[model samples]
Target: MAELRTEEEQVEALKRWWKENGLSLVAGVALAAAGVLGWNTWQGYQENQATAASMRYQQLVNLTAGNDLDEAQLPEARALVDEIVDEHGKTLYADLARLMDARLAVAQGDLAGARERLQSLADAGSDNYVAGLARLRLARLLVAEGDADQALNVLQSGVPEALAAQRAEVRGDAYHALERREEAATAWREALRLAATNEQPLYGVQLKLDNLGLESPDLEGSALETSSRDTTSHDNRGLDA
Candidate 1:
């Protein structure tokens, strides 16, 4: 009977040990799991905040469209854009805002200011699309200022494939302005080739060819006179019949 009591006591002690330490072990593991979940939730919240900042940046863009920089509202728009860029420069919208601001400066006829803004965007690292746009616009401004050589240099340096047709067309215009007719024609031809078939305007290409005294088979006929006569006859028939 004593041996039996000793065995019962040993079993009860084992049960107590398991009840106390096992519960604590399980609780510890659960706490560690919860901590991981909490960390992930915090990271997601931070990402969401950055995304909201970007959306606000886009709203600033809509507000500034076609608005004169000298107006009262312009300062407010600029302030919002600047805030986003300063606070969330890592966001894609920040880079886009800089490009938008530079374009606005250009539209306002602030060539010096535009160039300065564009230069900053161009030098910003890892923004290939914006940098390319800056270079292309800067080249156009240079051409407008009668700096054909510099414009050509900008084109020769590099331009993105998406802007190739526009670059070629502008370069052709610059060359034509410089009295380099052959170069202009060559550039225009390249532009025509690069342009999508459906998107390219045939009349503009024909005009360019004519400016270079180049004969275009497409414009060979007196189609305009015939169309005009047909339209006149149609109008007269309604009156007569």
Candidate 2:
């Protein structure tokens, strides 16, 4: 009889304890499960968004791959660039699309628009490689626009080390534009050396050197002869992409 009474008292104690704590215990478990589910859903959503962006960017690349984009195709290509930037502005694809947008502006003979886009990217103050690319391209445009002084000013600040070859090349172009032949020769020589060290396949540097009455070992193969003419005519070829 004593044992039975002790067992009954213990059972009553457990029931009272559960009544006091069970609601909070159950709520805690429910909250944890919801947190896990929410995190999983968020991850899935991000994956889907990235996939969509990749597909769209690929489409843009295909459309703009060749130099023969017709008049009708140009508008379509620009629309894709806008769409990528609008939805995925923070993405690499968006940055590349902006680069393409700048090129499109050039094709349409909108030099001012090209400068605006390139300058925005250059001044974004990011350490991204794309920013370095932007600076280089912007310098090219500034030179093309007969703003060689401004181009030199833009290049006064540094670019990504990987882009040092192109930076030197552009400096040469700017100097060449300003009729500073000796400095252009010096910069072009440095560019050739750095290009070889960087293995970055810089084109037309040899031709520039040769034009300046300096000879460099051929660096760009068949491009050695043609690069000078292309750059002389276009002033925007050989962007480091």
Candidate 3:
């Protein structure tokens, strides 16, 4: 005859197993739920911060656009930007605030301050589009500071491909300042070739070419002569009277 275990024995074995492993399983589930809630809270906090920063930034923009910004208003704008940068430096709005600060510094003739802000942005490694603009503007400031070598170096080395034409133009200007005429001419030509039709001013490139002793074709005269010939032909056709 086989021996049979009582139902009580099976229930006790299950209780022992639950006692050993059940708490661990419950703890894991609790941790996962906490993690999900924490992530959602963090996301909501970020959204709220971004919204507030955007509103502040818009106010700054309106001040500038309305021409209500003076030296007094500059401080207010600066304070707001500083606040946003300190609180939400990782946000897109922070990058915009930095750019605005740089522009305001330039307008105030605080070139050194502007250069510093732009350099910081260029090195931020967060937003490449803004970084590219920062590098380009920094190069211009360096050029204005008579730091031709440093400006040329920045343009040549730091500029991204999207701003290559502008960089080449600035490089040409730097070369010209350094009296490297041949190099300047080459850079200008490269800039002309790389610049988009809407982005580049033809007259500016023509002026550069003229400075380099390159001849510009007299398109006006050709157009005038064609118009005269067309007028003469039209007049002849009407002369039957």
Candidate 4:
């Protein structure tokens, strides 16, 4: 009889514990399942968005390919750029699109618009590579527009290490525009050295140095090696996208 009573007491204790914790346990499992479902849905949505953006970006590329920016081609290309930027601003595609848009602006002879777009991207600094590229291009435009001082200022900083060669090249251009031949030669030499280090092909830099009566004998093999890699290379600026 004592054993039966003890068994009944244990059963009652278990029942009470379940009554206290069962609801919370069920709620926790439901929450976990819901969380998983929500996460999957979010992932699916993100994948779909990425696919759409990539497709549209490809269309933009097709339109702008080969530098065939004719009257009919420019409008469609610019529209595609706007579409990608507006719909997918968070993606790298959008950043690339904005850069393409700047190019379109330049092609249309809208220098002010080009400057605005480049300035905006450079100021965004959202992506270091893209921002640095924007600054470089903008500096070139500034130098072309007789604003060499501003170009020099723009090239003073914010360029990425990967693009240090290009930055130096643009700085050289700005200095040349300002008739600072010695500084231009120095900057171009630094550019050649950096380009060699990074194995990035820089066109006409050696020629610029030659014009300035400067020579870098250490770059003889570098020039041949880097230029050899250039002919087979495709535009990889969109890889970030």
Candidate 5:
């Protein structure tokens, strides 16, 4: 009889312990399961969003290929670009779309629009590569517009290493426009060096130097050649005297 009584007491103790902890344990497990489900759902949604954005960006690219975007195509291209900007503005594609839009503006001879687009991208702390590209384009446009000083100022801020050669080239152009021949030569030389380091093809810099009749080696040699010529002329004058 004592053993039976002890068994009953033990059963009662177990029941009370379960009553105290069972609900809390069940609730904790349910919360954990919900959190896991929520996380998975969120991940799936983000993946889908990215895929959709990529498709849209590809469509934008297809519409703008190899043509000047004639009047009929222009509106469609612009609309597609705008849609990308509106829906995926935070994505890399949006920045690309903006860059494309700037190019379109240029093709249309809308210099002001292109300048505005490029300037905003450059000034807005955009992705480093895109911003560097915008800055380079803007500087070129400024040079084309006969604003070499402003072009120089625009490029004074540093660019990404990938763009260093292009930036140097543009700087050289601006300096040449300003008739700062020596500075222009220095910039072109730096540009050539950077291009070689990056394995990039640089054109026209050598030609520009040649046109200046100051192709570096000749620049040094020209002074000596001129002095020699002067000395010869002086000797001939002495003979004549």
Candidate 6:
């Protein structure tokens, strides 16, 4: 009779403990499970979004791959580019689409449209490489439009090291246009030096220097002769001017 009483007391104590803590323990487990499920759902959603963006960007690329786009195909290509820009405006794909859109506008003789697109990318702070490329293109267009001062201003805004050679060349063009011969020569010399450092040959810079009565050391006889033949025609061409 004594042992039975003791077992009953122990059973009662366990029941009381569970009654005090069971609901809280159950609730804590439920909350943890819910949190994990929510995080997995969010991860899945982001993966799906990235996949959709990649597919759309590939479609855009296919539409613009070749130089054989005829008049009828151009509108469709441009429409696709616009759609990517509208839907994925904050993505890298959208920035690339803007560049392609600008090129399309140039092809269609829409200089104003092209300029606007290029200027938007140039002024944006998102991607330094894209901004630098846009600045270079815009500067070239401005120079072609006879706005050399504006071109120079654009180049002065700064560029990536990868674009330094091209920028200097265009600066030379702008200076030449403004009749700043000394400045033009200096810019071209810098461009040539940069190109050499990059292991890229700037073929005509030396020719231009020669026209300016400047000599490049160790130029081959055949090269000098060939360059002289074209000096009169190419002296004013300026690198990518």
Which candidate's TM-score is highest? 4
C-alpha local distance difference test of each model: 0.57, 0.69, 0.60, 0.71, 0.66, 0.65
- Residue-level lDDT of model 1, residues 1-241, one tens digit each, is 2123222322343354446556764465466657566756655665686678757775775676442444666667767768878887755557666766665565555678877876677677234555665676666667667787877887785566755765777788678768898888887666666554324221254356555786433322243222212211111110000
Give the alpha carbon lDDT tens digit for every residue of 92-175 in model 2: 667767877887787777778888898887778233466777788788888877889999998887576767877999999999
TM-score of each: 0.62, 0.73, 0.63, 0.76, 0.69, 0.65
Clashing pairs in 1: none
Report clash pairs, candidate 3: none
lDDT of 6 at 104: 74
Write the residue-wise lDDT of candidate 6 on 86-158 in tens digits.
8767655576667667767766878788888888888983556667767877787787778899999898875
Task: Give stretches of model 5 more than 4 Å off.
Answer: 1-37, 217-241
Ordered by TM-score, highest first, the candidates read 4, 2, 5, 6, 3, 1
Error of 3 at 128 (Å): 2.1
**What is the clash tally of candidate 6?**
0
Displacement of the residue 79 alpha carbon in candidate 2, Å:
1.0
User: Which clashing pairs does model 6 show?
Assistant: none
In candidate 4, clashing pairs total 0
In angstroms, give how far residue 241 of model 4 lies from its true place: 18
Task: Tell me model 4's lDDT, rounded to 2 decimals.
Answer: 0.71
Residues 1-241, candidate 4: write the lDDT tens digits: 2123222322343354356556874565466657467756655665688799889987986787654467789999989998998898876678777877887887788889998999999999456667777787788788878898998898888887867887887888888889999889888878878877776667666666666775455554566455434433222111111
For model 3, state the Cα shift of residue 26 in Å.
Answer: 29
Q: Candidate 2: TM-score?
A: 0.73
Worst 10 residues of 4 by lDDT: 232-241
Question: Per-prediction RMSD in angstroms?
Answer: 25.4, 21.9, 24.7, 20.7, 25.9, 23.3
